[model samples]
Target chain A: MTPLRIVTQLLEIAAALIAAPAFLGWVNQCRAWLQNRRAPSVLQPYYGLRKLFGKDVILAENASALFRFAPYAVFGTMVAAAAIIPSMGTGLPLSTAADAIALVGLLATARVFVSLAAMDVGTAFGTLGARREMMVGFLAEPALLMVLFVAAMISHTTSLPLIAEGLTTRALALYPSLAFTAVAFTLVLLAENARIPVDNPATHLELTMIHEAMLLEYSGRHLAMMEWAAALKLFNYACIGFALFIPWGTGTEAGGPAALMLAAPLLALKLAVAGAGLAVVETLSAKLRVFRAPEFLATAFLLAVLGLLVYLLLGA
Target chain B: MAPLSFDLQLLNGCAALLLLLSFSMLSQRRIVNLVNLLALQGALLCAATLLVAVRTGQGHLYLSAVLTLALKVVGLPLLLHRLIRRLNVYWDAEPVINASGTMLIGLLIVVFAFGLAQPISALASTATRSTLGIAIAVILLAFLTMITRRKAMSQVVAFLSMENGLFFGAMSATYGMPMVVELGVALDVLVAMLVLGVFFFQIREQFDSLDLHHLESLKETE
Candidate 1:
């Protein structure tokens, strides 16, 4: 790999690490605004992370090494995912080794480690949360794969950067198949990220908690890493959506550094719009009953399959 | 050629949407909502017919489109609404198969329809021939809806939707039927609605319910 490509890859990872929590903060702020409440500062997630990192670490008496190691593994997986996803430019050296399927595998790896650690704590809430997390993961994963498959079929490549490049260079016309898959992708994103209409991230009620219950045992810097990794996962998902569907602003081979520079602002603008749209959707839709989650994911899976069929039948 | 291809694309999109709506109708349980879906399907069929008429410049197809708009879109739905309001039937009881299972069967029916239409579509010359499978799927789905539904009102709506699918199939295959046949079908549908509307009131008076299962009890059993 050239020095510039390596530099671009490193820049992409660093941007993901720094900007992800702010993206969360932006969504939270937008949600507050839509709910007619005073909004929190856009840097609130950063401040929350800083405070957690500075606090003392607390370990449970029965905590195993897996509990201590899970945070790092999850954090590493998110970073790896960030590196592979072409958020700013499509010329990343790391992305060459990983395709869209591999990217999904990375996220699933993080999920598995976190859920295992949650089970290892031997707490009732921990195990309950772990079970619910696995349920959500099991249902969401197929829909996620189906969405990626639709994009892969359209581009005729499984690679993330190449999919972005392929979609970007196509003539500007609406693809009905893409429209179906886009709705499916949005549903999967909401479910996978513990967003509203799936699980409410802000809720700490033991009866309703899916993600927070698993983290109830964590404290201090470990918690900080876990929170940061969650933010990075959300950011990675958003980037994947952009790479597949709205890939216009991303830098291509001939454009080089100039295009890369332009891509940064474009990425920011896209994220801002996406975050706001997410907040609005969350504000409008009520959380589904936990048992209803299967139906929701099944609808998403069916819609993604419909998109594929539209392509095959209509050749659209 | 460019404009013709663009129109073909639009027609294909409308066909895909019609199939999706058919699936939605098969899974829908509310009697009122099923009537609304029937109206929507009629509107889409009318739109598709108009597009095909414009592309093929078939004057008879234009008249058929107008007839579809008048009878299917506006007139039938209005009559169904009035009948349901008078009969006071609003929701369908649970079907023999669940919603998801019905949808799965609908998907299978679509694949089957595609396989069945393959030879026919290959032989067809219309630009919208690819949608022939979708039309067949829509018809089969409407039949499925009719079999699963308990309420007579829902069955009537499904029956109307089936007519819609047949009309779409004919339009895609050969532009349209002869004007006399089209007029006969329209008259037949209107008469069927009137006769079914009177039959509903008679059944309701006899059994004090609109569920078709009530009529099954009228059979002579050992």
Candidate 2:
């Protein structure tokens, strides 16, 4: 690869890694503000990461290689995912390998690893969580694929950079298909990220937890990596959606030093708005009972299918 | 035009034959025999895809061919056969539609599929675009089979067979999908088979028959 492209990819990766913690903090601050309480500092998540990194890890006596390696795998997949998404612009060297479909595959791969590790310990809760995780993933993937296909049809390409470029540079007209898909994608994102109306990320209640239940046995640095990976994944998802839906602020093909500087603040602004929006969504929605998750996802599936039908029939 | 490459003709002929077999399996009601037809369909799909891969020099098609051979031809059929023997669902009691009715529906779907494929063929820019209609026919027929069959195992086989049709379509239209996609689909089919295998046991445990009409009761009826 050319050095310039490599440098750009490195920059994007660094930005993603640094902005991940800040993004988490920003969401918390927004939530606190909305609740009319004094918010923690925006650096709180960074501090948490630092403190976790410094602590030594304790492992279970029965921990297998899979359990020990899951953290790294999780972190690696998240980092790889972050690299593919156009956090700042569409000019990363990784763009060649960064297919929208492949992005979903990477997320699914990480999930499979994490679920297997969760089950390796043989705890009842862990097994329960793993089974539930698989069920959610099983239902979520087809919806996500259909969503991706909607965007793919619009751009005539599955590449993230190409999609972003097409959306931004092409006509300013609105697409009804993408509008439907965007809503469906937002719901899937909430469910996939374990947000409200699906699973409460804040709740440690064993009966209610989905993402958290699997992480119950983890502590210290391992937990930190998992947490950071989760944050990175949320960040990646947001950026991907932003690039796909709102690609205005990102730099163009002619990437000069000035373009890069402009993209930085633009991306930050987008994230801030997204963080607030996410907080509002989480605040407004109530967590559904676990049994109802299928109905919720089924609704998402129907919406996606409807979107596809609109695209096919209306020739959008 | 010069005679199509030997491998290309073989692939095309096999593709057409595979679609025909898929329609046959869709109309069949005997559970044991359906699984056998599905296995044969898988074998034909594997052979077709391999022929295309060899002619086009796309290495990924070989992997896809192997995947089809291992998963569809051998693994899934074996699982379904075992599921049938264990569940004792040698014959579906009665289809949701009789064989003749379902076959007539299948025939209509094939016509619609050809009509739908015309525009796709115009844009495909592939020698095998004509087979695209056959592919769509296979998929719709499988869907019809799923809707018409009473046995759960039959639906599962139809689902896998539908995937075979999609694979064939991709090969004929685009010379095969990306390697990563083929790999992902292969993994998905494997996992789906294993998961469905377990589900069969659970279903049999609950109902003592593989008939899926029982699952219709699972709907949240008002």
The most accurate candidate by DockQ is 1
Residue lDDT tens for model 2, A148-244 = 8988887899998888878888756535567667778888888898888888876786587889888887888998999999999889889988887
- Badly placed stretches (over 4 Å) of model 1 are B1-4, B219-222
Give lDDT: candidate 1, residue B74: 96
DockQ values, each candidate: 0.42, 0.02
What lDDT score is found at residue A14 in candidate 1?
90
TM-score of chain A of each: 0.99, 0.96
Off by over 4 Å in 2: A1-3, B1-222
Q: In model 2, which residue pairs have backbone atoms overlapping below 3 Å?
A: none
Total clashing residue pairs per candidate? 0, 0
In candidate 2, what are the lDDT values of residues B1-222, reduced to their tens digit?
234555655555575456557656865678888989989998998888877777778787888889889888898888888877777778766777765556557666766877798799779887777677778878888899888877778888889888988987888789889989988988888898889888988988887777776777855463
Error of 1 at B127 (Å): 1.3
lDDT at A237, model 2: 85
Return the TM-score for candidate 2, rounded to 2 decimals: 0.60
Global lDDT of each candidate: 0.89, 0.81
What residue pairs clash in candidate 1, if any at all? none
